[model samples]
Target: MRIIQLFQVALVLMLLALSNEGRVNGERGDRQCEFNPSLSPRPHSVSILEFGAVGDGKTLNTIAFQNAIFYLKSFSDKGGAQLYVPPGTWLTESFNLTSHLTLFLEKGAVIIGSQ
Candidate 1:
């Protein structure tokens, strides 16, 4: 009985030591892989208003949209480009998207298709 109790205690202690070591190693690995925003290339953002997009829900902004996308395409080599539509109603026709372009719409922003 004495031998059995000692063996069980030894086994439990070994498991505890191994688990603690694994946890320490896991924490160290996580620290090594931590995210650093400055090390990564940041995408460029441009608001539709900068391209003369009038979001009054009445003005047709087809040309503005086209110009904005064309301008954003210029920055495709530097990470990517993001087109931001601010919070307002934007009336425009259909527009095409270029490669490496992201369209971000803020809350309460609406795009109405006009005939």
Candidate 2:
């Protein structure tokens, strides 16, 4: 009798797990990930080049990135800002990211860490 009860409990747990196998958090069907570019549009936009960042992938752009964010910090009250990175490989050390600033990277643009 004890063996029969244990088997029944195991069967019930297995059925519960199988019922939710194809669902995510009780939601039916699969969901695709999506990114909407215009979800948070900034009123101000500035390019990294404006701050003297060379995208040759060799120049250490730590100062450039720092300066850019520092400059854009002023726009925090005016609907935020976007720091645009053009198509190239940018090398930089660690830098601080300010609030209300979006680091926009264009196609083919990449940022590499410097030693």
Error of 1 at 61 (Å): 0.7
* Model 1 alpha-carbon miss at residue 1, Å: 82
Q: Write one digit per residue (lDDT tens) for candidate 2, span 1-115.
A: 9999999999999999999987876898665446655657799999999999999988899999999999999999999999999999999999999899989998889999977
Residue-pair clashes per candidate: 0, 0
TM-score of 2: 0.68
Off by over 4 Å in 2: 1-34
Tens digits of per-residue lDDT for model 1, 1-115: 9999999999999998877773664564334435545533337988999989998999999999999999999998988888899999999999999988878778789999987
lDDT of 2 at 65: 96
For candidate 1, the per-residue lDDT at 41 reads 30
